[model samples]
Target chain A: MNWDYLLSLFMGGLTRGSIYALIALGYTMVYGIITLINFAHGEIYMIGAFTALIAIGVLTLAGWNGTAILLIAAVAAVVYAAAYGWTLERIAYRPLRHAPRLSALISAIGMSLFLQNYVRMAQTANFLPFPNLIPEFAFLKPVAHIVRSSELVIYAVTALVMLLLTLLVRFTRMGKAMRATAQDRDMAMLSGVDVDRVISLTFVIGSAIAATGGVLIASHIGQINFYIGFLAGIKAFVAAVLGGIGSLPGAVLGGLVLGWTESFFTGYVSSDYEDVFAFLFLVGILIFRPSGLLGRKQMEKV
Target chain B: MKAEFKKSLLAALWFMFLTFPITVVRVNTIERTVAWRWERLIWIGAATFILSFIWRRLLHRKQTGRREVSAGEVRPPSRWKQMAADPRLKGLALSAAALCFLVIPLLFSWNKTILVTNALIYVVIALGLNIVVGLAGQLVLGYVAFFAVGAYSYALLNYHFAVGFWAALPMGAALAAAFGLLLGFPVLRLRGDYLAIVTLGFGEIIRIVLENWNALSFGPSGIDNIPPPGFFGLALTLRQTHIAIYYLMVALTLLTILVVHRLQHSRIGRSWEALREDETAAQAMGIDTTGAKLSAFALGACWAGMAGVVFAAKQKFINPGNFTIWESILVLCIVVLGGMGSIAGVVLAALVLVILPEALRVFADYRWLLFGALLVLMMVFRPGGLVNARRRAYAFEPSAPEKSERP
Candidate 1:
């Protein structure tokens, strides 16, 4: 491939990877803390996108500036998604904690189905064009390649969010509590951590990040749909697993790897099999390193 | 004997009572237009529901005395005894009777071959899935990948090498198995949901490849007019030789079931179960966990490949759309609802899952809703499955001399 084309592909992959990484953080965090896949996290993202879409639409109808409207929409979507995440855990997952892993998984699947179909029923099962929130501007014009202002915005926002999340987990008391709970729930509880509250907060934070990713993705893609979550959810989950499912940094790395793989596959081979290439990469990673790149392998008790 | 006779008589009476209104509705609807059939159908359904409720209540009352007599003697039955005492013989007898009933219709029918052929195709898919999910305890969400591989392999070979169906069949299976090996390597480290997601991704990738690889897969338009299997000098076409294809499908299905059954009871099967029950324990027991898991994937993929060949021949066309995630989910549902690890359960499930939707064609729009509801209900009520495998019981008895140790 030509350098210019390669450069564009690289940029595209990076931008897309950033979004995947953002969404994947949510998966990694929830999995780290509760060992649940949080299957509905993608739906939470979908809700966030829709929430932003609605918020923007309403604001624009009320004659608000595009920048001001986007800011409000982002905040509203994150808060709404966080609340939704909190309620979802309380209602579907909390009681099932003592149940088998499979039961919780099935419940998660149920919640996913309920949310997806509920959205399908509520909204028309078609892609709704997301209005351009950020104006298009060329960041890199030297190589005849242009980066949209939206892409730059998404990358910056995602990086900022990731940085904030890292700090929150590393430095905050609640973050330490979450880490403790994740290590051993019983011990965490014994240590006077409100394990339940910590878990709920984890979901809340994860959902908020996912919501942000969703809005960014919607804007980047310029369209949103009810079924968008299905593939993205799986991919994000793959990213989580690839990075070492429970590790935050691993998720970001996995997401970038996946995004790069897809971009290269599409660039070199064909766009049609982009999904296939990505999965093959995932499968390859799993075979060689089951613990993922950054994940620690645990010995199963016989 | 007298009580048995009375119970049989009552059951027959109840059956006739429920059937009477349905017959009446059918007769009445014959004079009216077919559009009004729904109204009559509703009325008949209501009547049947009421009759069944009353019959169940009466049966419940009569069973109370027998319950008291059998109280305090609840002991587990031996596996052999349980198998021998199974009431499925009546179902077999009923099927035999139904076959006889259909004999005259078959002679006069034109679509007999198609119905049987379709059933056999489903049987193949079910049996293939049984090897993966049922025998191995590995949840594969993108089984359609193998199916697609088989179909496309056949298409490419037929077009390029001019290989006939028989040659393509083995080639297709081999190709799918190769892909399975490729997939199994990475996913060997992953378990359950992680493996499932990867497999799902693999499937979508395959589909997208089929859609985008225009030179090979012909993109989304797919390969058309796929040639049927030619045995010796005879060409098996859908029109004149539909019965031959039907028999071919039946033979293939039988072969699939036999292989699956054999594999399920083999050492490999035991290893799979060991891994499923406790992977670490299996590994500790000297089982090569990676090899076992790969074998599961390869074998499962091989069967799916064979099914794909059959599907292509039956349809005389192959398209990417035919292999979708929903199709994979449906197959997964079949294995789950059929009772995991039980061959008979999977077969029964496949039949019901396929036939029920066909039977409910009139309620087409509500089919998915009903299917989803049934899945949720089944998981809720009998998550183990309809014919849950009996748990192996230990023949442990407290020794009189050892009793003081606990005290």
Candidate 2:
């Protein structure tokens, strides 16, 4: 049994899962509150990566060093992504709050398309090379074959983000408001919670996390284009659904499960049908457990 | 008005900030070059400034219109609605539209004929999708998979066994229906959003399989040189063939419209409508919700299959690229923008969406961007779509005042 090969695949899955979890967090959080799938969430991630690239390019031209450029670019990505998310909710989604569920979904889809084209038109359609910002660490030379230094960073950052998010959701006054809104929006509004503000904040927080993931993944993958968000968004959404969409832990677990499944399948089986396998897994999960693994079974109110 | 101007100004400024990174900075990492596009910033600022004012005005008007309605103000019927209600005008409009359809193709060049023919094909496909989404209320994101199935079935069968178009049409449709049932059966139990994702997944699976499974699908380069439908085995020239396809599409489109109209009035159609409104209520009313949903999928898939076969014949080639999720979205946009469940609306939308792009080739780059914006704006401002399907009205007359009964 090739233990080393298995270990490498495991690490690969972990890295991939971390990225998925970051994006899925946004989808789950937004869906938890509004019950509207923010289709443009993926586009926010794309925008983040593009923003980071632009920042890096400008900083490099200004003769900045590596670490400072990375830091500023990441910050720029997060801020811009959060802004885009907040604005998107206001423009495309807010007016449709009183409308039918399908209307919001369509609008979300439209926003996604619009954003994708906006990037394509503003930038280039060809793949832009994402610079690898994370340097190789000399300390883990022996186990370097199993896991790259960047993968370790991704895991650590994802863990830290999750911990921070959990703390925010559990302890803060705003967190309490968000919880109330998610539980029952009308009740929350009546109880003096600003529902609109809470919803916008959720989008902001989600988009910020997704941007972090976008920046990290783009660096890892070494290339990005206008269309990366669509597939990634779909996969992340799938992971969120697998985890039982409204549940944060469920999203993380789902991401890990999906990432592992994809990595192992591609590692062992033919890589040609990797996407097919992921999609089939989604279908199977949806068919068997519609509410998801961690999602509570919602009662149909009479 | 002053407040509105201030808001628009704020919006314009916000847009300028939002667009700074993408619009202002162009980075080519491979060449290590940074191109600063300052003009784009100006363009964004200008566009947003003007658009914001228009947007605010429309929103204000919409709000006022809603307020008037809520306040019990009796608004007169719109001119279009009144014209539609008048039999004389309706007949005149119908005949004029028919005359245009008949005369325009003959006057058009081969490219124009092909474009119109494609539009006609979409009209059929859109009507099919209307059955599932508009009528049955199931959002199948992978609707294009069935279309692909039909196309591939025809393509492969013709390539292997020399099966002609006439022989392949029914076979293609049946195969597509089978595939629809295959997808619909498992997903029947899921809710709307979940169903959408699963269908999307199913679509990707189909595409990936087609692209990878070289032994079966010819692997992405696609099947080509597939002959157009034979007119008694006569070798028609390219222009003649295109004209034939156009006429064929016209005939098929008419058939689809007639069938869809009939279905909309049928018992099954009512069940679909009921299912769409509220599944639980529909089920409580003894409508087999499952059956209705499944039938919608099968029937919708059947039409897509027919259209797919025709699409293959028209193009004389079949590839995975022709049946992407975007194609499904395009058909969906027609069903939606035209007004769900409205046969005439679907036809009109299909014509406009398909033909408008070809007609306005200069705005090709901004097409998808505008489409996305249009979808959002439509949802925000006009959720009922361009033409709301007229609801059935029945008048209840009180024959006489029952004074004795009241006493």
Q: Best candidate, DockQ-wise? A: 2
Interface root mean square deviation per prediction: 12.7, 1.2
**Candidate 2 per-residue lDDT over residues B1-407, each given as its tens digit:** 78877887888899999999999999776687889888988888888989998887787788898899999987888997888999998889878987887776678787888889999989989999999988998988889998899889899999999999999999999998999899989998876777777888888888888988889999899999887898777789988898888888888888888898899889999999998888889999999998999999999999999999999998888889988888988888898899888888989999999888889897666888888898899888887789898755685877677654774
* Local distance difference test, each candidate: 0.75, 0.90
Q: Which segments of candidate 2 are over 4 A away from where they belong?
A: B233-235, B396-407
lDDT of each residue in A111-188, candidate 1, tens digit only: 666666655654447787788887656544453354667778888997898899999999999999999998989999
How do the residues A171-282 of candidate 2 rate in per-residue lDDT, one tens digit apiece?
A: 9999999999999999999999999999999999999999999999998888999999999999999899999989999999999999998999999997999888878888
Q: For all the predictions, what are the DockQ values?
A: 0.12, 0.82
lDDT at residue B345 of model 2 (Cα atoms): 91
